[model samples]
Structure formats: structure tokens, C-alpha cells
Target: QWDKPLTSKVTSYLEDAKEFVPFKLKEVESAELINKNNIKTVEWVEAASDEEEALPDTSHRQEVTITFIDNSMLSGTLVSDTPRELSRLSDCLNTKESFIHITNGERHIHVNKNMLLRVTGS
Candidate 1:
């Protein structure tokens, strides 16, 4: 991570890199962000009533739940003031994109928006 803002561009990690792994959202079935214990099962809540305004913002990292089109959900933490392009679930939920990038600690995941259902935070 650089000191300045990092946009959600297809990066090869090297500035002068000629080729990078193209992200084909349509072809991707599922992806996972490497975690400490590699736990993939996240408890799916049928209905979460925690309002965004009701949640305290004192904590830099807020708990978030991302529900996909298949009804499967992933519970993770997100930075309070994340960038716009990467802040779909935080800054503004109105802007729907083709993917949802989530950062949980050192883990980073990009969930295809076509398959994304809802993003709930608390």
C-alpha cells in the first residue's frame, strides 16, 4: 500500500509491467481473500436490522456483512473512511459497480457485483 490513494485499477504490482492478470468478472465463480485461519464459512443472517447510522464510527475498522446473489454472506471488517471506488459498501451504497473489493486486515477480496446482493455494516 502506498502513502497516497490507491485506485482500483488492474495492477501488476510493478509500475512498468507490460501484462497483468485481467479480471474477468463473468468467468469468475468465486474468490477468497487469504485469511489467518483460512476460514470460508461465514454465518449467513437471514435479516440484519443494524442501521448504518446506528453503528458507532469511533472504531476505525467496522464490522461488515456482504450478501451475495446466492444468499451466501461474508462477514469482515472495513476501514471507516475508505476511498470512493473501493468504498462501495461504506461511503456510498447507491453506486453499484461490477465488483466489490473488501479489505479484511491483510486480506483483500473482489466480489463480482453482478453476483453481489447487499452490503450491510455495523
Candidate 2:
């Protein structure tokens, strides 16, 4: 870890690096043991794309209630480029990616599928 610390999301660890590939190298498991994680979820307070919001008809947003594996629950909105892009709530959960994007106003919360028990009502 750098002496000068900075917060990062799932990716974007090296803020200044030009060519950054997440998990490009094989890291030792012991490194994680040294780093105690208090991270429950990775939530980003950021702006949504200008174009997406500008075209209201083209934008697809869905509200969902998630129950985590730990039995904690939350409600969030999922926004996508188009409904066909991710047609249904089930499709979002079944996507190849491990993380699903849920928006809370300007905030984007990427929840890991591994931590989910059941996700409903989107």
C-alpha cells in the first residue's frame, strides 16, 4: 500500500496510472489478511451520464429491494441505457458481471452478487 492513501472503488486503485488493468497480477492471499476490510458495500457518490438523463424516454430505470446474504435489506434504483440492454431485474442479477449497478440519486452502488441472498421487486 502507498504511504499516501486514497480511496478507490472496485477498480481505479492507481489514479495516475495510464494503463491500469484490475487484478492483472496474482496477489498473495496473505496481503488481504494484513489489510482488514471494514467494507460492507462500495457506494460511489458521483454524477450520472449527461446524455442518459437528457433522453428521458430512452432511459430505463427500475426500483429494486435487495436482501443481502447477511439478512440486511435496502431499496435502490437501477438505471440502464435501455430496457432491452438489461431487460429485467432477473437479467441484471444473471448478468455475467459480478457487480450490479444500483443508483440512489447521484450515488451508484455496485453490490457484489456473492453477498446477495435474494433480490426482488425491481
Candidate 3:
């Protein structure tokens, strides 16, 4: 029951929003309140794509493992297409948004940069 179109990307939905948002968990079968600080990583298994034009040009895909303050790890692929995101993964991580979006095949993960202690590439 979101106001936005189904085609909108999760990254876009999270951008410029409030500190907390409603997130549905299929495993638990309920929507939970998610704050930027509390969320270490939001992962989507077999994630679907939105509109192609809304997505990055995606010339490169690199695998990255992120470690949080609590020592939890979530590994996913980081895609870079634009010039700003092209130079390095850190550049992409430095976006205005608090979440860093990464993908691997059908898997997509958004890591909270603020909660991350380190990010290693593989």
C-alpha cells in the first residue's frame, strides 16, 4: 500500500526520506520500522529490476563484503556505471543517500554506510 509506483527502485524510495521507514519482511511476514542507523544491511534475494532507464549504466560489477559495527557481514556485488560511481566503490558509497546499493545476480543489498565499519572487495 505504498504511494509510489511499483516500478520505483528501493534506493529511490529511501532517498531523501525520513530517518525511519516501513520495511516488509517476507520471512517474518510483517512490516517493521527501519531506521537508517538501526539497519546494517537490507537484503533482497532474487530481487526484481525496475525501469531500465532508472537504473545505472552498469558497465562493471564487483563483489564487496561489508562489515558492520557489530561484526556482521553481508557480501554483494557493487555495480558502477556513471562517472561518479565509476572511479571507485567509495565514490558510490559517498552519495547523498545514507544507504549504499549493491547487487549480485538476483540478489540486492543496501548497506547503511553509517553502520559499516569496513568494506572489502573480493
Query: Best candidate, lDDT-wise?
Result: 3
Q: lDDT of each structure?
A: 0.45, 0.57, 0.67
Give the alpha carbon lDDT tens digit for every residue of 9-119 in model 3. 666766646887888757888788877678766666653444333344544666888888889877777765547435577776665777777876666677778888898
- Per-residue lDDT tens digits for candidate 2, residues 2-117, read 43212223323322233323332266543222111223366756544432433245546779888988899878886454457666777756755545667776666767667788
TM-score of each: 0.40, 0.55, 0.67
Ranked by TM-score from best down, the candidates are 3, 2, 1
Q: Model 1, which residues run further than 4 Å from truth? A: 1-61, 79-91
Higher-TM-score candidate of 1 and 2: 2
> What's the distance in Å from true for residue 52, model 3?
7.1
- Model 3, position 28: C-alpha lDDT score: 89
Position 99, candidate 3: lDDT: 77
Top model number, TM-score = 3
Better of 1 and 3 by TM-score: 3
**lDDT of residue 100 for candidate 3:** 74
- lDDT, candidate 1, 8-119, per-residue tens: 2311122223323222346787653333222223222222332222223442455778887778987776443345355554454433333334555445554544555677
lDDT, residue 76, candidate 1: 73
